[model samples]
Target chain A: MKTLIKNAVCLIILLTAVIVNGSGQEYVKLERSRNLQLNNTSAGQEISINVTDEYNYLRIKVEGQFTMGSLLIELIDPSGNISRNFTIEAGGVNTSDIRADRAGAVSGQMQKAFRNPAEGYWQVRITPRKATGSLRIYSLQIYNPRTDLIELEQIEKDTDEHIG
Target chain B: MNISVRAPISKKSIAALVPFLLVSVSTSLAQHKITVDIETDTTIWAPVAYLSLIPDFNYLNTISYNHIIEQSGISKEGLYEFSTEYLPEEEHLYRVHFSKKGDPPASLILGGRDHNHFFLFAERNSNISVTVKSGNRFINDLIFQGYSPNKALQGINTMLEALDSIDQNGNIVNREYAIEAIYEDIKTYADTCSFPLPSLYALYNINYAKDYDNNPAFYRRYLHKWRSQKSLYFREFRSSIRGEIKPSWLIVIIAGSVMLSIILTMYLYSRLKKKNNKNPLSELTIQERKVFNLLKQGKSNKEIAEECSVSVSTIKSHVNSIYSKLDVRSRRDILDIEY
Candidate 1:
């Protein structure tokens, strides 16, 4: 019995070392999923993320039940310039200028690569006309080529805090 | 006499030893470690850094992480560690690159001129420490400790950075000439450096062909000096130069071909001279020569008698004398003789 326990401990330690040594590359700094009920009179929902020059890419995803031509998503840079505006169309989503849009059958994902991202807060404004459903928004700050699916500690939740 | 012989290891004993063997192997693999502490004020670098092994001493290949051996995330305390025993016993080049999110899998940003990567030298048993601080560039910010070759490489990197700053700032009037001067400095370092690996790295940065053309003797001497080194970098440097013809051997081959051609021509000329010395007519009198010329022109013995103003019997005696002097038996034999 003692020998069996010793063998199990050794096996566990070896596996743990291997796992810890290979972990961590891409970091997820911000992920927020919000379900909203919007009408023609409701105010537009705005989501903002702090993008330092170190961040190489930013991705925005929108999903859930919504009518065609009812939801509009706008990406604003640090200078308050609207870099991209996404609109929900029949069977897909269309962007104003940026071309990296992979709209799934249910959800639409928009990814943007920055050569040198401006060091300030970026905004995502979502306006809906008589829409009711849940919308998920998450941003990943890529650090290198390696990918690891590990969530970091220290998760903060707020209703609408201005970020920088 | 009674003798107790030990039996082979039983299946139970073998099974019991398996976990211990695995633990020993894992511990051995974990013996070497490279740790980096990021001290940068600005958030330019990503949280992840890659450790890549360079297959050769070619400095240009260091730009890409094609041979990534390990990838580790920086801890919350800004410490990144790569622990592995897979490294070869001999020291080799390794790059630790900190790239931003969305960066390419290989190479640095801005056509590999980005300063996010630094190099180090380590063997399988080496433990290295690095500190990255805030500076003008990544190389300027790096402080590598423990490995002597890494320190030597860092010194070369500092010089190269200084040289490049001049070009980047447009401080020199003749950019082309200034760049050539910088290459000359690197060549001088390569020639004088005591470390073979760092020396090879420095040598590969400059135009090898131009240097070899300008002074092939330097390469010959350098090759001879480092020929016996056991480092794979030295071996690679030697093989890279082998692609070109060794200048001294080329001279020997060209000179040998010219001498061989000269000797062959002289031998043929002497043979022709000996043949020329054997004149057929030198053995005959003037009357016999006239008779020989008439016989060569298809004139019979009677015709030769008319042409030479001699009797037919005298012409026949001259023909026989001509045949004997020239070593021929017939008139056709005389025609076949080469002058």
Candidate 2:
């Protein structure tokens, strides 16, 4: 049978080049990353994260300058409840997508993903439902996934150029 | 005439269906009473209390509980009622809140930080009560005795928490003109609040899509003075805040006043075509209009060829044909034409 159909087309091109080089060598196990500078005052601010059972995911990424106010950004869990919240206003960002920067203030990012998330402490409050601003935590990170999957848009462009 | 039926009833018709299901559950627990005293500290809040109705006021920060409707629990002297005989007999907007019972299945208890929910108006023969005092701040020491638009919605949430504590104590040195003069005293207390559902909950706590484009005639005189008050939150504030108050700076000021009146009508039609080409010498040649009236009488193209009998090289060819038909440059701009 003609060399077994040329060794089955050379073993299907070496198993499609080892599944496209193992999905272009994806990786993520970061576990924690910071870059904080927070001060969204007016009696508001809380950020704790201890989430153990080996991280699953959690991002934060704010950036602000402020021309007015309104902040919010919850997350809670580990049983204090709210597992996701965002606001960041001056008349914008109530459910993500803000991007303005170049000194025009706003920048957003809020994330949560975990099938097993609840492992002890995990807070991230930051509240200021209007007036009191400047919260540039460019990255909070905490990662997990391994067998190929690390995309929150390439870790938000390598944690905003490794903290701009 | 298909009339088939099946029979299994007999124990004296199931003992006559338990007193008609306890008289329809005690006439639906006597049609509504929403109690709630709430002190709950099951190690930091949650003996359970939910409620929800919120079909408007943009679902007040809905993180999901797809409008809950009911949940009770509390009782070891913390009270808690809410069955609200299937709500909806007009005045709606309810929401009660309190979480922490290991929330995972539909969580959201929003009201910003530890303010975990309050809102109320209620109906379906409301009896309401709501005390919630234990360590204060449950929406700032909640009180409300039997709904009168929840005490003018707790005095418009304590004048919007004193206008967010005067924009968090930077005490307004023109914080956008003192937040539009405290949103015109909260739209004059939602135009004299005597309950049109707490003046639509004090104009949805004065954020109404960021001050409805800075005063859309006070939201069109609050939708024509509450257009004969019907509800679902004033028909979703008359169909979603009435045509989004045309904002983008009023379309960049009506496209910058139609591009400055189309650039001032092409600069007043090019100054009325340069004042109709500043004397077109009536489109010329009556020997260039007698050599442009003897070169506007200052003469000299050999005295305008001895007063227009022509040839001083034909009056310099009628002064270069009246300087190329009045777009003049000399004869001192053709004797400064006023025609």
Candidate 3:
């Protein structure tokens, strides 16, 4: 019985060590959305959005003068691939949601996500229609369904511990 | 009849006597004397007229006129109509005057006398037309000669003085011509006078050194004495100018400093890296430490083998195991590790 308890204590210590090391690996937080202003007068103004280690869902919102031109958003990955294409026409100053995984395989598409590609480097391209006007984007949100479930479970556990 | 004849004869005789007496009385004559007186007048000759020659400047003197007489010669009154053939072929100035007293000391007047064949000498050429007249009559052509060098120099000096006066009064219309004349005078003086080259060089150097900064080589070549003591002269020249630095020396100093800094930085970096790589975890094991300590204190591997009572291969195996456990790849790695 003593040997069993000792073995159990050792196993617990090893598991604790493994857990501590595993959790020690850093986790990064990304802002849910960002606003970008693209005035058509200037060219090569790059807007980079990071989508690594997060759920693939993306939502873009735009508000500006709309004409016959189109707004183009390209999803890029680690291998320099255009994994998805999102197009919105004039008067389409609204939110558009997409899942990057379901997008078809194409040349120059990002294959797998990266942990840290580079600081401020883009995994996506957001290009507005070239016209004589200013474009104001209100928000871009990357939503993960798994993050909601995890937050819900945490809240439940905290409530149970508090009641007990 | 006889008586009548006697009376007639007597009467005839008486009548004849009367006729004879009348013939004798008829021979009478008359004589008268005639006398005549005559008067005459003579003209006295006057002196010949002459024109006096005057020099432009004092360096020249007037000379006598050698007049050539024509076929008529000079008139008794010394006044005659001059013919073209009586004019002198060569031109000159003559101090000619009229003289009725036959020669030199007679009273002189401005009357021009021309000869047909004599040459006259004068100081300068005449520009005015000389029409010799006693009252309103014209004379022959007059000739004039030019001044000699001495006289020319005097004339030129007077002209220069006049030019100077004009310049002071601000009346120089053609300044370039005046400058050219001045330069020609300087060149003439320089060519005629013997001046030392060194002195001339120094004078010009002082005059132009400030504005001659662009062509140092030209000055240097012409003024070789200045370059004879090159170092001293260069030092003086450098001090005269502002902020003169030798580019070659600056380049050497900068390159040397940069190379030295790079080498020193690399040396320090390599030393720190060597110190960091010498950890016991990377170079030593526990068994290796024990064996090394025993070997350091003079224990043989065979004695170790005998004490452990193992074969030599087993001892070798233990040694190999010690080497592997020490995490050392070479003996040098072990030796290089600090205690």
Candidate 4:
């Protein structure tokens, strides 16, 4: 009876671990969504999102109901190099980041040459300014959506959670 | 004429010297006299005026003006005509002062060396007028009333500058293109500038910078219209516009065009990307995308319900909503999506 009980306990723990990891992994498959809370934010605050190798394209979208705040997001590759960036501002300024805008997209798929990408760890850094609203990350993985040919769904989250 | 040589030499030597002297005298005859008639337009003053020439216009010598100090006495004596022996040079810059004793000081008289062949006719108009060629009398009495022969001096100065651009640099820097550019500027100014001085300046520019080897009278038409306008605003506006645009304008246009192109490209690219990422499933709430992702992964309605910390019926309702948006009938259709 004790051996049977031990086996059952082990199965439960294993299953729990699998569920958490699976939740994270499956979320990255396509149009992955994640929520990050911003509260009483002050200066010198930063958040980094590391995109691992396995996804073919890289695009990031930021959506949230912000009453007052600004955020600057930058992409860093595995080589520890910054690749792309974007800005969200209610009232703020843009930094003097890399000015190579010919390949301007900081949060889109691989540029001009298709099927070829900077295959490695791509990191995302977010710097917030007077931010007090939740920022929704609509994509958590290298995304290749099938039916998103003509539209992007505005995220319908609880308005109370996003509005500052 | 009787020739009597003092008796210091022989008759043959005198005869030889006489012919040589006679030939030299005839060859070196003094030039024809310059006859300038100065009379006020409002009241033809006793045709008395004195004319003088200065080698350089800006280097005016106050002491030399209004005096009887000319090689050929050119003084107005109770008459409008003043005569001085013609200068050896074909063209000269002259200043006119009334010969009347109580007349206004010569300093009060303004002068300009602008007379080109145009001055021949200008010798006929009202402002200060002059002529290098003959026909000063036929000079339109209308032109002589007030003319400044000094306009040519300014043109000559600019012409020298254009030449110097080539000479001072020892021809190491080519200025033909720049001179041609200035020619175009002058032509445009001549075409539109409403101010008298600027139009005059434009005539000067064209006269100085143009390659007369191609067209000498290119600026001739502009000279006739160089009348001072009554409206200072229009005059100043027209004069101010010429130098405002240069290659810098072209640079601004190109830079602006490039900046616009870059902005447009970025905008379109973002829109295309947004379109490509469009999915009806994206409209789902964060909770719904979570459930939808699980559903897309071939999870059964029960598995999604079990994993989500929600009841099975709630999960079923979410699935049905997802199916409605995906335009599919069931979970099988969601799995069949070509993601």
Candidate 5:
């Protein structure tokens, strides 16, 4: 009877640890992952990835300097579902889809369910319909339910291979 | 022998023949005096007559006769002094009689000769003539004709003509009665004539201006006064014309248009206000309100599912239902509702 109880306690602790570890995974961060430098003449550009889990979440922070026109950010999920598609404009401190006639910085976030979107491949597409001057994106991040250990290890190995 | 018989009857025969011849001669030449003479300074003339016998003393004793004879005056001792006054001159009639005691009581008509008797006569054979001086016969004739502007103007014209004739010729040759007649005509015309404004203005301006020539002082003063008076007259005439109020068709049309516009504006405003007051949101159900409130609060499908203890798929169905009820699509439309 004593052995059974001790075993039961050990099993409960292990299960609790697994649940806590799964639930508390670190959010995925993409820090200037795409070395994109948009100038006055650059066209539309896109960055995308396939998210396997339906319960995963995504958070994107876009920072850029654009002169004239607006920057459109669109999220296209795997199941052909669109979510949190919006346009960020220049020249104002607040997040506005429409800006006045001047050059300035813009930053905003968009979140959505990963299960279904209006398009395949979890995507972030930036379109500058009338961008003038230089447009440089400083940061962009995507949040998911998966743990960061595997992704960080994979990024380190790719960097070492590129160096060799 | 014949001569001796004739001498014997001579005294008686002579006596009878002398008386017979004297009686016949005296009867043939017998005469009586019945003369009448009008004694007045006024030039009014009329016929005079005295009746010696009454045809019926009781029925016609107080006889009243309207003598409208043509001539009037007196005659005496075979000399006739007829009134020189003309037919249309002063002609008046009078009733006369023997008013004295112990005299023959007979009615007489005296004065202006008309259509009746012309002379006074007594029952006894008498020699008589009537003599009358001229009176104001011209004025009397005009008055008897009645007051008329045309007749009065004619009289004035006649007097002016006479004056012109007298001025041209240095003669008292025209009868005194004619001079007197003209004077009387002028007086009567002056009394009856009423001058109109146009004629009076012309006369006043002409006569008033004639007094001064070299120095325009009088004219200046008179012009100022006359201008004021003329302006006053025109103002009075204008007021008289304007004071006459008559209804105009334009007045009725304007009044009716104002009234109709007011009524139409009030009716349309009332209808619009009534329609706006009856909102469709008042018919919304509790479930619909909950969904709508959450939508307005900007909750995602997962947040709404957790709050309502339902699956995310169930929340999607509720969102669709809310959209149909609110008649809107997309999350951006939630803020556009009036309520």
Candidate 6:
């Protein structure tokens, strides 16, 4: 009986260990534009972050000051697939309840499922709405949870912005 | 004591029922019609203009329809088009667009002048003129026609300015009164006129003045009176405005959450199952892994075979399996894999 319990505990621990390593996350910083005041015109800013690790699940979030849905974010994965996209809309967060003051909390997650991601260039493109306002701390963040034992948190990448 | 009742059928009884049904159907079909005079100086600008009568009263993201002057433009996703040709005269019949009889009201915009640039309430038998002055008037109101836009664009502009307008001491004024006043103004038009555009003018006002958004009494009692006024021009927008307002959002949120939960549960379960069943690392055997490590380190097949005390052919076979697991081709491709 003691041996049976011991074997069960060992099996549980092994399963837990594999599960812990199976779900690993990496954060990628895409763009950083601080304290910007935009007018009655639109501007687009883009950046590329190299995700050296392969992942199955991908999520995107924005930390910004141009209101909830004023900024449009489009993410292109390394394999040239548009992973996540959101734009200025009429009702769902875009054309209403925008403050021109301090920055707010991180946006809700915009998630996607990848068949199998490549380890190459992942692009984040942003299109601020054609509005006149003041803003602070506009940036994009990516959280990728992988299924492999690869250590994504260890790989560090920084890149320049691409404007359109 | 209660009495049970049954009536026998007759031609007279059936004939009486016919008038009642006909009255119901005719009342439903007797929709409001408005003649519009849109005088565009075609000599001033290009003959092309875009027109859209999008439904604002919809909670679900229903695709709306529009038309182009030249009819040569391509349709984009979510926005569709109807075949159109300019009547050559500025005076045209601005079709009255409404939902089914006893349905939610819809708004209309006209511009021989410009594509959906002016807000003209699609009222029953409303006669109005919208003549754009010198420059382009990209607004949806009668302000540019005969008077200055200040007072004419009241429903559209007043609500916008009221939202963020500050007081003398630099404080944001409570916009309740401002919003209430606009509704009161729209109510004046809604009461005096039986047209669809007037109701839509009031409807569009509620978009900016959100406090008055969901009123079942108003939709059921007032909008239900004008169902027969639906036109093909605004057919898509007409069908999309459905059900009670807040419940629509609740249903959408619940449905969305349930779908996401299912997807996430499946995704995570698949990942766990793949890890257990595949044992991904075991795809390459002990010998193949050693060969893989050597190949990653830039070693030739001959050198790897010599180091492993095996023939070159054996090393080649191991290398092929390793390459297959890693989804790569050739020795150069497998060199320096960071993942």
lDDT of 5 by residue, B152-189 (tens): 33344345445434422223245334544565455334
> Residue by residue across A41-158, what tens digits does model 1's lDDT show?
6668788878764543344333333323345666687768655454432223223211233221122333333323455887888886654434555554443333221222111112
Candidate 3 residue lDDT tens string, B146-216: 32332332333344444333332222245436634653453343224232221231222222334236545
TM-score of chain B of 5: 0.23
Q: What is the alpha-carbon lDDT of model 4 when measured against the actual structure? A: 0.44
CA deviation > 4 Å runs, candidate 3: A6-14, A17-22, A26-34, A38-44, A48-69, A75-81, A90-112, A115-124, A130-164, B1-339
TM-score, first chain, each model: 0.50, 0.31, 0.36, 0.43, 0.45, 0.41
Top candidate on lDDT is 2
Please give the clash total of every predicted structure, in order. 1, 1, 14, 29, 33, 17
Q: Rank the candidates by TM-score, best first.
A: 1, 2, 6, 4, 5, 3
Instruction: Give the CA lDDT, 0 to 100, for residue A31 in model 6.
Output: 42
| TM-score, one value per model | 0.47, 0.33, 0.17, 0.25, 0.20, 0.28
- Report the C-alpha lDDT of model 1 over B178-269, residue by residue, as the tens digit: 66788788888888888888888888767575578788789989999887887767777677677676557778899999999999999999
Evaluated on chain A only, model 5 obtains a TM-score of 0.45
Report the CAPRI category for model 2: incorrect
After TM-score superposition, the amount by which residue B201's alpha carbon in candidate 1 deviates from its true location, in angstroms, is 2.3
lDDT at residue B178 of model 5 (Cα atoms) = 57
The full ranking of all candidates by lDDT, starting with the best, is 2, 1, 4, 6, 5, 3
Query: Relative to the true structure, how large is the alpha-carbon lDDT of every model?
Result: 0.62, 0.63, 0.37, 0.44, 0.42, 0.43
CAPRI-style grade of the A/B interface in model 5: incorrect
Q: What's model 4's lDDT at A64?
A: 37
- Model 1 CA lDDT for position A23: 53
Which whole-number lDDT from 0 to 100 does residue B201 have in model 1? 83
lDDT of 2 by residue, B124-200 (tens): 87888888566774556678897677887887777776654443233223444665677678779888887787777
* TM-score of chain A as modeled in candidate 6: 0.41
Best prediction by TM-score: 1
Q: What fraction of the genuine interface contacts, i.e. the true contacts, does candidate 5 reproduce? A: 0.00
By DockQ, the better pick of 2 and 5 is: 2
